[model samples]
Target: MLWVKAFHIVFVASWFAGLFYLPRIFVNLSMVPPESVAERARLLLMARKLFRFTSVLAAPALALGLWLWLGYGIGRAPGNGWMHAKLAIVVLVLGYHHACGVLLRRFESGVRQRNHLWYRWFNEVPVVLLVAAVVLVVVKPF
Candidate 1:
């Protein structure tokens, strides 16, 4: 159980690192001036590879989380409201991840629907979600 918990933490941290960074890349991507073909291409490649690697990391993190919750019964009790809140945040995080993919696709298609400032704000979403999740788990304030 401890080993599982440890690995889960590691994977989650790694996944969050990707979540934190990919958006910064998007910010840079959005800021890239037209005619900088090589820079755009390079940024796109980095975003693509990071997204793929981050996705790979997310799978094990989520799987181990489920294992901890279901198999280990970490949050099955009646008073585990913190767990419920954390789960909701997880869903939001997943949605944010999908949104990132969509944004990447749009960028790939040469759509510049949003400015860099918007992406800068967008990049902060996961940070807040991660903080909430960590607090929920560690403090269990519910």
Candidate 2:
């Protein structure tokens, strides 16, 4: 159904938006001086909240993606290379999601230092991967 497709697109967009922004929080957290207790707490709280909200959308996006792939034959999308690449990126994104959870837990437990520049650099990774994914999905460029 067109409505299902629309919901899928909206939810996917929401998920990506959060994915893109999550690392920026890390970047900000890294910039704050290590001794700034209040600032550190605030940053950790923000990251936790954002991750939780984004995860809610992500689960459904994954479910709906699978549903559409099966129900609407998206697996039959013409280009094997593009489809394969997209699937790989999807796995990478999922990895990043789980990694975020792990990283947040480590930080919350005071096992890690938050560095702004490191997070800024980390932010570029998902952006690059997502760009490739978008190209594969939209242009199907081989």
Candidate 3:
């Protein structure tokens, strides 16, 4: 159980790192001049690779989170309203993660239409989620 908890923490942190960074790559991608073809290609590659890596980290993080919740009965605990709220936030975070993939696909196919400022704002999503999640877990205010 302790081992599973440790791995969950490590992978969740890893996923958050990717979540925090991948959009910043898109921000740079959005700003790259069309004339700078090579640089744009490189940033695209970086975003794709980071997205893939985050996908990998997210799998185990989610699995362990589920294990902790359902398998370990964390969700069954009384007065765990905070956990439910945290799960709601987790769902939102997952949606944000999925959107990153969609946006990455658009960028890869030369279909992305959003500007850097949009992505700059998008980059803050995980930060807010992270803070909310940590506070929910640590403070567990019900």
- The root-mean-square deviation over C-alpha atoms between each candidate and the true structure, in angstroms, is 0.5, 1.8, 0.9
- Report the C-alpha lDDT of model 1 over 1-142, residue by residue, as the tens digit: 9999999999999999999999999999999999999999999999999999999999999999999999999988999999999999999999999999999999999999999999999999999999999999999998
Task: State the C-alpha lDDT per candidate.
Answer: 0.97, 0.82, 0.94
RMSD (CA, angstroms), candidate 3 = 0.9
What is candidate 3's lDDT per residue for 79-115, written digit by digit as tens?
7899999999989989999999999999999885999
Clashing pairs in 2: 30-114, 30-115, 30-116
- The parts of candidate 3 lying over 4 Å away from their true place are none
Reference-based TM-score, model 1: 0.99
Alpha-carbon runs more than 4 Å astray in model 2: 77-79
Tell me the TM-score of each prediction against the true structure. 0.99, 0.89, 0.96
Q: Which candidate number would show the highest TM-score if scored against the true structure?
A: 1
Model 1, residue 95: distance off in Å is: 0.4
lDDT for each residue of candidate 2 in 3-42, tens digit (9 for 90 to 100): 7778887888898888888888877766667689999899
Q: Residue 129: error of model 3 in Å?
A: 0.2
Q: Which portions of model 1 show Cα errors greater than 4 Å?
A: none
